[model samples]
Target: MYWEDFLHVTAAAVENTVSSKRVDQFKEALGFHGIPAGHVPPTFVRTFSFGDIKGLTWPDAGMIHAEQEYDYYRPLVPEETLFCSQRIDKVVRKTGRSGEMAFIYLTQTGKDSAEQTVFISRRVLVWKAAGQRSEGVPE
Candidate 1:
């Protein structure tokens, strides 16, 4: 997995976007996890990402509670709700127990109606061995 230092992906805000299809999928997942329906908030989708990194570039660990929040802009809803995802933007080296590991992340943003700023999102994951951090290796 360490060799997977770089990656690029493309995705979109289709008609079934976070507000629709994803909401349904996440609700289903919650049900499978023994959680009641509606227990999972729409924001929980933020938890469903590649964010396993910690203490280094792990965004949540680096800044203000690793939080993401936004309000619905009914007026800004696009004529075509389908959005797109782009490539993995960055990856960085980190210390690990077994040796070194890479932290990989990607970005996805969407714009509508010439809004000054659309949606900017990032997903990240760690490439360290199970005990890599315990072994104290630097990548």
Candidate 2:
């Protein structure tokens, strides 16, 4: 029942404020102790990320984070508020060593109050076919 209806699952704008505390925490998590908190870490927006795309079927088990890529127009700064949104970009089906599986690509974009793009994050999630085993794993 994987219809193209999922293509319409774009979300409404989600907003977040980049606070000083958030910057510090994100930096600390990455083990950057003395970096200026003025510029946030490249992946800091993940702290306020959302993945709720309508009609998307998330696997309860055996789902893997296949890949992630980020494009930064500029570094996010503390005290800057950003409006963000997420959508499902595409879905692909393929048969590999693990059997038939699906790859779902999702992307999130963040913009400043002035409507300038700050960054974009693209992530891929893999849903493996039932009963499939990864290579080198015992059946």
Candidate 3:
């Protein structure tokens, strides 16, 4: 299968409920004494972002997370339910020191119960085909 086949593909929407305990655990793990009122940690959305990559088959042996960006429309509140979905936005191929690599761009979005967009997370993942030499590895 070609990379083009994955472009624009969307995963099924999933619902996530922000639990106060989970938030507290996250805060504690990160050494945050407290957060601003009415807002969960921005990185908390990572709990839902993985749902975006489900059901996609990659031709590569593994992938590296190259970049991540998040656009927040509003503060995410603890105890709020969010509906999240992910889509493959674009795919680009390039020759790198490791050999040929594929850059997969994906967007994951979260919406509130009221259907307003809460956040959009964009990610870039780098992948090398099976058997491709990695950087600095002797052939």
Clashes of each: 14, 0, 0
Segments of candidate 1 deviating more than 4 angstroms: 1-22, 31-80, 112-118, 129-139
- For candidate 1, lDDT tens digit of each residue in 5-122? 3344343333223344455576677664654443434344353333222222322221122223444333222123424334555666667565655665656454453433345556
Please give the lDDT score for candidate 3.
0.77
Residue pairs of candidate 3 with colliding backbone atoms: none
Scored by CA lDDT, what does every candidate get?
Answer: 0.42, 0.74, 0.77
- Writing each residue's lDDT as its tens digit, candidate 2 over 82-101 gives 98888877878788886867
Sort by lDDT, top down from the best: 3, 2, 1
TM-score of candidate 3 versus the correct structure, residues matched by position: 0.82
User: Whose lDDT is higher: candidate 1's or candidate 2's?
Assistant: 2
Model 2, global lDDT: 0.74
Sort order, TM-score high to low: 3, 2, 1
Give the TM-score of each candidate.
0.41, 0.79, 0.82
lDDT of 3 by residue, 12-131 (tens): 778998888888888889988867545589988887643644445544346888999999998888898999988879888888787877787889999988999999999998777623
Report the lDDT of model 2 for residue 19.
Answer: 90
